[model samples]
Target: MKTKIILVIIIVLCTFFIGMMLFIKYYSPKEKSNQLLSNVSVVDGKQIISITAKGGYFPRITNAKADIPTTIKLNTKATFDCSSAIVIPGINYRSYLPPSGETIIDIPSQKAGSSMNGTCSMGMYGFVINFN
Candidate 1:
């Protein structure tokens, strides 16, 4: 009886340890690429040029705005540059983003159909460029 109890206790402890190990392995956080949005539009004419950052993490843009020559509008603040900006894929244009707390960019209507891309702290996020 004593031997049986000891054996049962050892099995129970082993099962508990195995369960804990699996839980930790499954639930542990790992580094992952940040989520991106599809086809963010700024205005019509303007296009995103390039995004730069000092770190690998996303860069927050402040007082973001879109400019089509003289027209400019306030946009929402983004956790990263392209996190809020829109791209059209294949376009070779970029925007001069301001350093404020606003996010969102407005592209000119005339340039809406062309391919464009947004700049991110990590890399370029393309949108609406391969729709031909």
Candidate 2:
């Protein structure tokens, strides 16, 4: 019957839409907002860069001062993923952060054109800080 065919078509479309929604919600690669200055701040003559670590590292790219002393503060809350194990190979720094707290890391003065990069232990998430 025409009614039966229409019902079947509607049910198929609904099922397909739900499946697509679930795929995007769980499997998509979520990146941080591409803000140039949203995550950088200067305090007491030191540049402090704050980034969030949860499903992924946010504000993935940051810009900061090079000549002044610098530190990166990572904020984590209920982060049980691979991102909890942060590694900064350039500084020979690696640590397992607390599930919900702030982890501060000190960095030596960087040259104006230098950049610092960090990654999760599994390398699935990362962030970059460019000095200028």
For each candidate in turn, the TM-score is 0.31, 0.71
Please write out the lDDT profile of model 2 over residues 1-132, one tens digit for every residue.
999999999999999999999887766633223343468878888888998988778778777888988889999999999899999999999999999999999888899989988999889999988899
Q: Write the per-residue lDDT of candidate 1 for residues 1-132, one digit (tens) a residue.
A: 999999999999999999999877666532122123212234454443223222221223312223332122334343355434433233344443444443333334333233333444235542222111
Worst 10 residues of 1 by lDDT: 31-40
lDDT of 2 at 35: 45
Give the clash total for candidate 1. 29
Which runs of model 1 end up more than 4 angstroms from their true locations?
Answer: 27-102, 106-132
lDDT, residue 131, candidate 2: 92
